[model samples]
Target: MLAIAEYVVRGALSGAIYALLAVPMSLMFVTVRTIDFAVGAYALIAAAVCWSVGGALGLAAGLGAAMACAAFMAIIFLALKRLGCEDHIIYALASFGLATALASLVLWWWGTQAFVRDAFSDPWSVGGIRLAPQGVINFALILLLVGALHLLIQHTSLGRMMRAAAANQTGAALASIPVQGIQVGTYLAGGLLGGLAGLLVLYSAGLDFTAPLGLTLSGFGAAIIFGIGSPLRGFFGGLAMGIAQALAAGYASAMVAGMVPFLFVLLVLTTSRFGEEALAGGRP
Candidate 1:
């Protein structure tokens, strides 16, 4: 039982980064009715840049690279819209292309070296369970960001406009709300959040060039686990995913541990209302 508790704690902490990744996914889905497959790429590039640069300047450079990538995605999105491409699948495919391109770029520039960094040399003991300070920091930071996002979405006038845009883009436009601008803003926010997640991962478990697609899928799975309606659900979903993966790793084979997240995604897609609605394109 104690062991189980420890795993849960560790998983929750690690899941914080996943939650950070999920926030952008949820935001993009709600605001633009599309998925940004390049989100994970944003994370990967950030981590790579941070690993190369190091220190405070690296952090800034990492974030800048991520947001710049997202800006490119925004430009593509606008171009698609101008070309009368209203299909959500097209947006997803476009982002997937961008993700692939970014991954290739990373591979070419950084080679196959894994991006990782250690913030602490020793583990901290808490309540009979050992924890990494970096993991705890990731969890705390995610909570702070999520809280701020909730307030931004629920309390502020800008939040109201975002909600209005999400609920009905035409109506929001009729009200003179800048719907496209809001979506562009959401993409930029995704870049910031995704880049942050990458940095956290760099200091925690780290990742490589091949990680972007998997990260994107993990975030998408987390977002839809409870519902993609809000970032709070994404947060919980990320924790659930992390716990499940940790438990799988504890008692199950490495293969099973890896399969845990994809399994959750499959379960949700097959048995949930969100899946049904998604298949039917009801949201759009």
Candidate 2:
């Protein structure tokens, strides 16, 4: 019983991180109708740059570096759009190229290795249960950010405009919404969220060159399960997916645990429920 509770806490911590990582993709897809296959690479580069900058300056400075990386990503997305091409799959392919280039850049600069963040601190223990302080902090911060983003989307005129643009770009243009600026914002938001996740991952785990791609896949799976294509359900959708993964890892065998996320997604697709209630996170 106590073991179950302990594992639950652990799951929540990790699940929150995954949720945070998933939000940007969800928001962007919901708002812009574009997919970024390289979302994970954007994060990887952010982590590397953060580590590099943090090494020289401080945590704040490292964050700046991550933001700068995201800013660069913003440029790439817009540049491609301006080139008269914005197909989801096509843009995602270009993102792949950037991912490869980023990976190479990381190898050139940092080599294939991990980093250590001293202030990240150790996990805290209570009532015979252990918890990571950094993990808790990350979780809380994400909640705040996600909540704010959701509120902004749901309540603000800008959010309405975004939804309008996402649904019908041409119609929205006829309606006089700045479709291009909104698109850029969507990509920028995606990049920033991904970059932040990358930095958090580094703080949580050591860095590796190939890890970003894997993390991107992980985030992508969770987003799909959560119906990220629809904004209203994104938060709990991502949360539920993260929690499902957490539970699988905690209770199942290593191999099965490794397969749980993907397997669950496949299961979701098999059922009609996934197609229905997309507004609530399930997808069609």
Whole-model lDDT per candidate: 0.88, 0.69
Clashing pairs in 2: 123-132, 275-284
lDDT of 2 by residue, 1-284 (tens): 88777766776667665676677777767666656666677677777777777654545554555456556666777787778776776766776777777778778888978755655456688788877677778778887888888788878999888888878889999999998788777777777787777777777765678876776766766666646664334455555666667778789998789787677777775564643444354222
Ten residues in sequence with the least summed lDDT for candidate 1: 275-284
lDDT of candidate 2 at residue 172, scale 0 to 100: 92
- Runs of candidate 1 with Cα error greater than 4 angstroms are 253-255, 268-284
Against the hidden true structure, what lDDT does model 2 obtain? 0.69
- Any runs in candidate 2 off by more than 4 Å, and if so which? 55-61, 120-122, 230-232, 275-284
